[model samples]
Target: MNFVHNITAIFIFAPFLAFIILLFLSRKKLKRGAIGFSADITTFLLFLSVPVSVEALWGVNISFAVSVTAILMAMILLVLEWKKTKEIEILKYVRKTWRLYFLLLAAGYVIIWLTGLALTVISF
Candidate 1:
């Protein structure tokens, strides 16, 4: 049981571990990009899932705020990158690869959150 718990903890912390590893191994820009992207997706989900109770996890609100800010900053960087790249086809490819996942994840989170909210409201 202890071993199982330890494994689960490691699994849960793997992303953070990976971020640390990337920080040490990758260029500063690459590490920032990866971390910023992950933060955006995480915050988007948190914002979508906000509930009206103190019983819920406390960190969600903080994470939601940080994520939203990170996403906005990332968007600014993305625009700058696009302008600097100067190649239309390459810019399109970069946009699709880098942003598509965040867009889809945000959409999915919104859909699930809306559905859940509707169900709760209807039930009440």
Candidate 2:
């Protein structure tokens, strides 16, 4: 059971790890896309696996409100950064695609939260 919990923890965190890699480390287009997609799928799986109980897993609580707030804040920062770095014309595209990007981030957070809860349950 510990092993399973460990594996699940890894699965839950994989997307966040990938997001960091894509956001900061990756340069190649293919690599970035692959990491992003992996993060999305892993997050989706985590959301699907959430248990019914409300508890903190690995010191992180899973809350929909928190997830939404995080996503909105992140998107705001990203948009601000994009506007600063890119031309106004390019910012339009960023604005259009921003929702999708935030949605993915939110999904990832939700998965992380759920996975944490699942691991906590498994540990007990």
Give the winner by TM-score. Answer: 2
Clashing pairs in 2: none
C-alpha TM-scores of all predictions? 0.30, 0.32
**Predicted candidate 1 versus true structure: per-residue lDDT over 50-98, tens digit per residue:** 3212113232334455457657766776777679876546656555534
State the lDDT of candidate 2 residue by residue for 5-60, as single tens digits. Answer: 88667655454554555445544656646655445544453443332223334443
Worst 10 residues of 2 by lDDT: 48-57
Model 1: lowest-lDDT 10 consecutive positions: 50-59
Runs with alpha carbons beyond 4 Å of true place in candidate 2: 1-33, 46-61, 86-124
